[model samples]
Target: MRKFDAIVIGSGQGGVPLAKKLAKAGWQTAIVEKRWIGGTCINDGCTPTKSMIACGAAAHVIANSQEWGITVSDFKVDLEKIVQRKNKVVESFRGGATKGMEKTEGLSIIYGEAVFTGEKTLNVILKDGGEEAITAPHIFINTGTLPKIPPVPGLDTIKYLTNTSIMELTKLPSHLVIMGSGYIGLEFGQLFRRLGSQVTIIDRGKQLLKHEDEDVAAAVKKVMETSGVTMHTGANVQKVEQIGDTIRLQFTANGENLTITGSHLLVAIGRTPQSTSLQPEKAGLALDDKGYFKVNDQLETNVSGIYVLGDVKGGPEFTHISYNDYLVLYKRLVNKEDTSIKDRPVPYCMFTDPQLGRIGLTEKAAKEAGYDVKVACLDMTRVARAIETGNTQGFMKAVINANDDKLLGVAILGPEGGEVMSVMQMAMLGGITAKQLREMIFAHPLYSESINNLFMTLEK
Candidate 1:
């Protein structure tokens, strides 16, 4: 049996960091990955999505060049080249991550499917038809999630794509039908639409981004509608079938029978945890009522020397949250710290055109949590910098606690909205009050000045 001080399953964000820490801390460590290195964010999800979005943004700029008095000629999307470039990016990072661990002290990288053999033992099935036994004092379950595909009739028989498969397409679909209105669907819908595809989004929720405040979602829906995204909220997709080189989607929305046809269907419903395959029960690990690993405040699982974090633990599923998990788990593992992955203002961003960013509680969430909430909202069209940029669309909403003058939450749905929300995240993380943020110096005619102006409207 090969023995190590620690073994980490999955080479995603959490496993990468924990493996590095264990090796750096003078402990023998090993990371076993069932697939490629660098995990989902690097290999598929974040990197490729952002690359394609960049192409969309470029298309938008060229399309609007006439507004800037620049004469432009034929601008077309070379999807094949874009896919190649994105693959190059992923390959570069995968190489770097693999190399980073190659020389790490007392660290071994295993490429295999690891299963629980005993409480502290693992049976690894390598791709090369080789079996190996490994034992470690501690095991970290960092196996990330897969795209959640709902049970839609005829969904399997048809060629449908998820975030994983969409980026690999050699050609853009003439028309794309997205199957959710969540961040993934909205982002990809906007991206492909900007790149010249007729995009339609169908969601079961009454509004896109149902997790956000209604006003914020409404503003986004308005902008998206203006940008030509056909959104069908409260819509249920009944089936998808192949119809003469096209895909026909059938659904019911608002008591109406609807059939939408497109060249491709992209399913962006959500992601599901990959825990069941690990058989955590064999290791005395219990999953929550949801499929995620049941983790405590210290990020520890029910089994001693085993822990869980990130998406598998069922919190915000941003790449940054996984990094934060590394910090919390690192402290607990190295210094024996008393810290748990507690309350911090976790910011989430949707990379739609102009983008959308939010941190801390939503207006409804704060009020529902029994706090006296004061709101300040303003349209970006009225903001000086937004007007200057000539892309004035969407709005900013700030939710403040009335009794304590503290910043409860801030949501922005406009140009540079993602960049603008970092200050709010810092404020909530550092316990900065709303009054203080309002008083902070912001340069004139800047997009961020909207933050100050929005706070100025806060009423007691």
Candidate 2:
């Protein structure tokens, strides 16, 4: 049995930095990870996926080189090389995380699965067939989440790929059938399509990105469709089975039952929090209906001195948000500052070709929240930078408070959309109004300069 000042379970985005901070504060911290060092962001989620997306983006550029007046005779996607490159990036990040923990004083990295044995105690099943009991006055859970596999008939009979498993592919599938049209599906669908795979996406929703504004969703769909990705909305997947070398997926859309055959089936429905294995019942911690650790605004669980952070605690499951969790907890716990997660503008980006960067509320959400909202929309074709790059495929939209001209939300779905959205995020953070933004002098011929035009469309 060993005792520490604090025990951090799961070396995830929040847990890693939190542990280091705690240890640096002279607290004896033990951070336990069952597998990997930097959690899902570095191991499988953001790091590896973005690396592959970058490769796919390069492939897209090379395939369309003739548009740039460059002629390329032949090109091929080496899946082996792509996977190797992604693995290298993952390793670099993971190694850096491990080294950081090692050098930090009062911090010990434990390799094992940790389960709550008592309110302030953990029993770790070591990776190498050993066990240890550790106790601490404070415990932080950041186990994160895993890809959720839907229960379709005959689905488990054949091997299917989840977001994590699909990354291990060293060979491109001839035809890839994705089971959802959400962010994960859209990203990988376009990725493999750019990599020369015939991609098909099926979704139960009537429209892609159902939560997004209709026009924004339509624009994203149009961009993806123009890029040669097939989408079947309003699709209800019924069954899946393997026939010879192909996987057959049976689904119905618009009263018509159909079967689609693909060399690979990717079940990208959603993710489930990694709470089941922790045995939270032992610690008497209650979970939400969706199985996430229920936490207060300060990210404290029902149990005092026990906290939950990142995806396991639910809400927006972005890496940046998870990282912010560390900041919130650190400020509240270490600096003794008063902070809460409420009323924070959450921003996220989808890594499609023309990235979809979104912040704050959508127009629909703002309207639903009873705000007198005014929307300003500008096509990418109108943006000088988009016109110069010839990558004008999406639009920029901003939702403003009609009474105060304050930006409620902004969505940019064009070249460098994520970067442009970050600027708006900062402006919103600083309480910049739409009129002020429109009058602001921005650098010419840059994607961000479109912000001026975006707000110019707003009625006074």
Candidate 3:
């Protein structure tokens, strides 16, 4: 029997960091993982996807070099090479995480699947069919989510791809059919289109990115359209079948029979928590109806000395947001510092062609929250900086409390929208006013400097 001060499971984004922080605090910390360290964010999600997108973007630039007063004779993309590069990036960080953890004192790394045999006792199933029991005062669950494939008829028969399996594609599809309009689907659609694949996206909703502000979502939709990505909303996909060499998608759109056949079919609907394998019921831990672990503010579960954090607990599922959970829980548990997941303005980004970033409340949210709201928006075409950069394709919007003129939320949809939202995120979190942004001098010839002018254009 081995004893630990704290045990963290699933060495992904949230678990590894939590284990490291606790070990550094002189606690006997142990991190248990079923697969490689650094989890999905490094292994599959953000890192590999972004790296592939970068290659696709570079290929687009090369294909359109004539527009930049440069001419190219022969241009071709080696899809396998791009994938190899992406793998290198994943491997680089995975090795670093392993090596770095090796240097930490009072830290033990176990390569096994952990389940609760009792409240404070975990039964670890080793890779080679050996089992060990470990006891800890506190436990953290950081297992992330996996892509969801709905029970569409014949979907399994047809060769399909998800976020996990798509990276294995060795050649570009002549036409790619994507079955969702969420961030994951949209981002991949853009990437494939840039890489010279004709893309058609089908969503069951009335518009793309239904969760985003209408104006921002519309802007990204327009950008994708201009870049040759066909989008269909209110789409009902009936079945997917392999018609000889091509995969055929049958759907109903606009009350008409819609059939699309392509070389690849990608199911990017969404993800669900990967907690099914953990069998949490044996430990007296209750999961919400939505399949997420039920936890209090301090990340403690119903079971004493057991804590659950990250995507398994279910909130905004961002890698950095999980890291923030690590900070809050680690402080309270090991350092005796108190923190809670409340009143924090979390900024989220959709990494599409023009990108989209939003923080705090929208005008609709602010008004619904019983505050008089004022709104301001400036199109990128009207901004001198954007025009100079030849990237005038989006807008900047601000929502303010009408009574006190305090900044409420800001949405940006344009070049580096994610970077531009950081300023407004800081303002919303720190209680800065709209007037402060308008009055402050920003650097010249930069896209973000347009924020000052956006606030100044307010008509309330």
Residue-pair clashes per prediction, in order, are: 0, 0, 0
> How displaced is residue 85 in candidate 1, in Å?
1.5
lDDT of 1 by residue, 55-155 (tens): 88888889889987887987878999988888888888889999988878788999999988778898999977899999988888888889999999999
Better of 2 and 3 by TM-score: 2
RMSD of each: 1.4, 0.9, 1.5
The positional error of residue 115 in candidate 3, measured at the CA in angstroms, is: 2.2
lDDT of 2 by residue, 128-231 (tens): 88899999998999999988888899998999999988999999999999998889999999999999999999999998888799999999999889889998
Q: List the global CA lDDT of all models.
A: 0.87, 0.93, 0.86
Q: Hey, what RMSD does candidate 3 come out at?
A: 1.5
Q: Which stretches of candidate 3 lie over 4 Å from their true place?
A: none
| After superposition, candidate 2 runs with Cα above 4 Å error | none
Extract clashing residue pairs from model 2: none
lDDT of 3 by residue, 1-460 (tens): 8999999988878888889989998889999988899988899888899899899878877887887778999888888999999999999989999988989999999988988887788899997779989988888899988888899999988779998788888898899999998889999999999988999999998878776677767788898898889999899999889999899989999998889999898999988897867878878889888788988888888888888777888988888888888988888876788788877568888787577888888777787799988898999998887787567888999999988888888888887889999878887777778888888788887777888889888845
**Candidate that would win on TM-score:** 2
Q: What lDDT would candidate 3 get against the real structure?
A: 0.86
Considering only N, C-alpha and C atoms within 3 Å, which residue pairs clash in candidate 3? Answer: none
